[model samples]
Target: MTVQLNNGFLKQQTGNTIQIDQPVKLLVVNLMPNKLETERQFVRLFSHLSLDVAVTFLRMASHHSKHIPEAKLQQTYATLTDVYDQQFDGMVVTGAPVEDIAYDAVDYWPEFNTLLNWRHDHVRQSILECWAAQAGIYVDFGINKRVIPKKLFGVYRCEIDQKTALTAGFNQLSMPQSRHATLGHINDPRLAVLASDPEAGPVILASKQTHSTYISGHPEYETNTLFNEFNRDREKGLPIQLPKNYFSKDKPTNTWQRDSIHLYDNWVHSLKKVKV
Candidate 1:
């Protein structure tokens, strides 16, 4: 998706005179090979928020990216080695298309594990999405990811577990998810379900004690995200399930893509307010 940002949103302040609160520097660990798009997506999500957010992109140095342009990576992303022991107010680990492989089988698993452990100790809060969420469960609590019989693709409705701080302002909000892996068969004692579907219950959200948040869905997806993915996979002859309830008339061309800025904003705000 081509993203364009409005310069009007940025306010000019003289730093030589005085500076206010420090901008919340977030280290976005993008497992998605397309570093350009991932960076733009994150910037788009957090740009509208009132908080000051500065993002630094981190990519796995061990795995060679095939989807993203090599030039883009050299220009925009940094390897995991570039950021170690650096304190970040927030951290994000994005999902990738590597769910088909075993966690340890992935080339960067060792470095990835190290990054996750560091986040647990340093970052105030962390967000894990889709496959990353599943991997996190495995790394943190020895939980495993199970392949479902079918791909759970679509705009699913999640009923909020109102008691949690993450759901403080959101109740019965609809989120977007496009993935083939699930955690239904995983046995993990530390995992907690913050919201669930009536049909697919136990979509884990947050743990009891950790500041990490796991979202099985891609709440940050653009309106055309699913549609684009569907077409791409179809062209590639990859087996992909249709996104259920994504189109207004259940037609691919009629899908109305929308932003999840509100949800993203709420999450960032919640992280700031959450006391560890």
Candidate 2:
């Protein structure tokens, strides 16, 4: 969220360059335990886009995050109250680790819902990634996410359907999915499935009525994300299997990173210019 002022950026503004426009304002609601890592992943993709973006990392005000230090949490993250009066060009709501828990049972459920309700008006366009995507779908379309028998973790090739700006120029794309809940049967007219895999089903969905998009995979995940997660689960004695189509001889090749970058670029391009 912090920007180091550089010569070129300053020159562009001071010299009145024709190409520069107001920086895109983006709000990221991070729900993961490793906040710093999540921040890194999202920021990496955002950094690749052509537009200059100003990002705000927001945390649930009511929930206490034990993973990050209290001092650092207060310093680095924003409470919903901090930016309630503001509006943004776009918002990114990341997935949480609480897929198995019922939505109402999560400690910050009320606060999360409050944020989503507020985003409907304040954010021009938005993305619901991973678990947040399923939650958003349930709230918006009255659909429920069923817990799958196995964790759907790995790189998957999804066939793109409806050619919206979000999925334009791609017949199919590779995505990294790491979730236990799946939208069993999406029989709603309000939402359109942009891409689907045989096993992963709907990988991307856009609301026909709203400016929000829902993604079932974690395109922001780095190459070793699933690798680290696999080890972490093993250390804790949690039941987990090797991620499908992810590992090769104990190493992972980044097959989905470029596609992920383009995916986010498309989302950024979909946003209209908003105030600084």
Candidate 3:
């Protein structure tokens, strides 16, 4: 069956959408403030996949999101308890703008921990992004994120390590980074750096034992995402700098689009070989 997508580029993808016996079920923990926009961004990539896939957006029940109305969240998003008995082909815990604060201090941290623990047994493959990456690593591997003096904001070229199923096609790719912290030297023998940059540190990390992937940057970001963020901070009279390698003339080029799509596509295709 053909699935209708959210909006914008996603709407045009209906014709090209893949048909299969069963869609790969994916659970995404929506930690970003703009839920709808994040949906559009991710669904856009999922639409390009060679197999059918279904995405379920999950939200934290403990914390009240001030940006989007609670009424809307309840109508669409699932809570941790809602999917406790369900099994998924893959899971993704997204990044949030809570890098400066300790993980336990966050209002939803307790429940977030519960969800993370659940992911291992119930989900086939899992990915943690940005702040979530730090949290997951600390919990699973005891790797703590260190705060940098300045926010590492902008597009950066990351060198891809020896190819794995998840990063097979690319040697090196440019991904956007927007964070206040970075993963320090990884001493754990199980954890492998799939991609890294001198300035951005470890951008993509993976561990076979955990069956999880961690991405430190925003590869799924829309071309204008960093641009919009920079303008917003500047307008609020906050300390902000122009993103490095992001602008040509006046607009930002989408340097990471192909790589981001490639990464997600690989993850979806690998689902068949994974057992929940």
Candidate 4:
């Protein structure tokens, strides 16, 4: 991705500072068409952490963007080749809408694999969300994503499995999920389920060392994200299920969903504590 520096956002590095060469660097590979909103989500999460984090946005070169402004995409993001040699404290790969088809069908499959392989060697830790989580399972462990009979919609409760750092303080966190595809039975030996629901698929999983986080639900979603998705699909005449327990009195306009934001904060705080 292009490394265009944000002039005002960049804090000047001082030689006399206590931790002068140790600022945490995070690279966010945003696959969402709404790049600005995705950027806001990451910013909101990172801002709450105690660490000083500098984020670099990475965009896929293989796909054309329709919703994002051309100038913003060009100015903020770069192709995978642009960040190959960089070492980062953490990385986040956002979800895309390509789960219905095979990964090979997407134009950037090869590039995506390259990014994953590079992360395996270079990145200290990484988070994969939604479809990106499915992609990780497929690529790294040969696990396939199965198209569910119906879309998994709304906010669901996730009980944290305390075996890993990702759920260090999480007890029963509710997360927002807005997606059409879900992973089927995963028989991969390298993957471990971290959180699950009897009705929904496993909401969280990780590789053995907690270096990689694969979350089926979107903990980073804003309160209005589910509402926005519902409205968008409704306008487009696409089939959408009402989010479970999302609306107050079954009315979308009456209540606010505050659970996602809280859950996301917990996840970020926990991730910040992880040592490589």
Highest TM-score: which candidate? 3
| Cα lDDT, model 4, residue 186 | 57
Candidate that beats the other on lDDT, 1 or 2, i.e. the better one = 2
lDDT per residue for candidate 3 within 39-146, as digits (tens), equals: 777776677777677677889999898886887677668888888999999898889989989988989999988988898889989989989999999988988899
* Global CA lDDT computed for model 1: 0.69
Best by lDDT: 3
Model 4 residue runs over 4 Å out of place are 1-21, 69-72, 250-276
lDDT of 1 at 79: 68
Ranking by TM-score: 3, 2, 4, 1
Q: Candidate 1 at residue 213, lDDT?
A: 80
Q: What TM-score would candidate 4 get against the native? A: 0.83
Go through the candidates in order and give each one's C-alpha lDDT: 0.69, 0.82, 0.83, 0.71
- For candidate 1, the per-residue lDDT at 159 reads 81
Report the Cα lDDT for residue 3, model 4. Answer: 21
| Model 4 lDDT per residue over 1-276, tens place | 112222111212211123324456678888987776777776666565555566677888877677766665665577677878778767889998777788899888988998898897778778899999989878878778878877888777776654565665556767777777787665666778878876677888888653788988776777678888888889999888777868875555312134444444455455456645
Write down the worst ten-residue block by lDDT for model 1: 6-15
Shift of residue 272 alpha carbon in model 4, Å:
5.9
RMSD, candidate 2, Å: 5.2
